[model samples]
Target: MIYAFLNQKGGVGKTTLSIHTAAELSGRGRRVLLIDADPQGSSLAWSNYREKANFTVVGMPKATIHKEIDLLAQDYDDVVIDGPPRVTELARSIILSADIVVIPVQPSPMDVWAAAETVDLVREAQVYKPEIKCCLVINRKITNTAIGRDVRDALAELEVPVLKNDIGQRVAFAESAASGSTVLNQKLSKAAREIIKFVNELRRLK
Candidate 1:
């Protein structure tokens, strides 16, 4: 299966979620491949920094990714795509190529509004590929904040499903990224448990 982490706005934790999800899947013994579809190549750099990454990571920052991904999918059990922020042709192609699209939205008005274009793109893709599963996950949510609860209510206005698990604003995420490691690789922590639960929820969607 192919899963793409996408959002029209930046700093929504798409790359962080993609890296952790890929690493967790690899730990489960799945042959995983992470494709960095963003021109920024953040995932590629993360892979480069890791001396012993379990899954394969590559950069494929082209608009024709939908055409190329199928051939690459045959070699791996799962593919995780970290998509670009803008709703360009490249983002559309990445959405079309994935079996599932996970859109990470920060719990704020600006981020929620920015996600509109991405939600529209997913809806448009669904018209052609109705089987494509798209979900909105709350990322970087501050604990005990009214804004977090309000964001969920606001997101209900969208025509997509919202994931039950919301990733908290944790320092561990930043630390993991800096070290080129996943939360799962760190000492047992809430961040690691949340990521594991998130991955399990994603699998249940399949």
Candidate 2:
């Protein structure tokens, strides 16, 4: 399965979610491929810092995504794409290349708008990749915000299948990414548990 973590805005935990999801999948003995489609190469840099990881991090930039991703899917059980942080043509191409696209939205109005835009793009791409699946993920959520609840509720109102677990705002997510360790490799935290739950949900979908 191919999962693309994407959003139009930066700082929404797109790459963080992608990397941790990849780590969780790999830790469960799945052959995972972490594709760093982001030109920033956050996932690739994290993989380099970790030195040893359960799966391979392929920092392939924007390219002939269709052919490349098709060939890549041949070897890995799961392909997680850390796409560029903008809902442009490149990101849509990546989404179309994916079997499933996970739109990571931070618990904020702006992020929600960005996520909505990305989802719109994905919907438009459905004219092409009709079988591709796109889902919304509330990343960096706060516990008390009614606004957060509103966002989640709105997604539910739209009948979108949201992962029950939400990745909270955490320093651990940044710490591990900076150090090239996944949240799973770091000390256990709410973020790690959310990621684990997410991986489990994704596996069940497969």
Candidate 3:
């Protein structure tokens, strides 16, 4: 299976979610390949910092990635793409190549507002690949905030399926990223549990 984590807006935690997803999938014993489709190479840098041997990490930030991923993906059981931000051509290519597109939105007014374009792109992709599955996930949500509480209501206007499992605004995620590790390293932590539940929900979509 191929899963792409994307959003037009930056700092919404797309790379963090994608990295954790790859790590969780690797923990499940699947031969995972994390494709860094973002021109910024955030995932690549994360992989370089950690140097973990659990999965393969490759950089393929081209717009023609839909054409190239097939060959490279053949060797892996699952491919997780960390897509680029604000590049429509590349975003379209990633959407076309993925079996599932997970859009991570933070519980912020700006992030909620920015999701429309990404949703529109997904709609366009579905016109071509009718079987492609997509869903929105709340990421970096601040608990007890009014905007956070109302984010779902705001996102509802976009008419996309919002996953029940969400990732909170936690320092653990940033700490893990800085060290090339993931919340999975601390299984008992809330951050790890949230990611586990999120990934499990994704599996059911298959």
Model 3: CA > 4 A from native:
none
Residues 1-206 of candidate 2 have per-residue lDDT tens digits of 89888788887888888888888888888899988988898888788799576898887767567567888888988888988876387786787788888888777677766777777878888998789887878887878989888888677654557777777877888877777787776546777787888877776665
Displacement of residue 190 (Cα, Å) in model 3 is 0.5
- Best-to-worst TM-score order: 1, 3, 2
Can you write out model 3's per-residue Cα lDDT over 76-189, one digit (the tens) per residue?
999999998999999999999999999999988888888988999999999989988988999988888898879999999998889999899999999999988898999999
Worst 10 residues of 2 by lDDT: 153-162
- Local distance difference test, per candidate? 0.91, 0.80, 0.92
| Each prediction's TM-score versus the true structure | 0.97, 0.92, 0.97
Tens-place lDDT digits, model 1, residues 1-206 = 89999998998999999999999999999999999999999999998888586999989999999999889888999999999887489888998999999999999999889888798898898899998899999999899999999999999999788999889899998987887777887647989988988899999999
Candidate 1 lDDT (Cα, 0 to 1): 0.91
**TM-score of model 1 vs. true structure:** 0.97
Note the residue pairs that clash in candidate 2: none
Reference-based TM-score, model 2: 0.92
Candidate 2: give its CA RMSD in angstroms.
Answer: 1.7
Q: Which has the better TM-score: candidate 2, or candidate 3?
A: 3
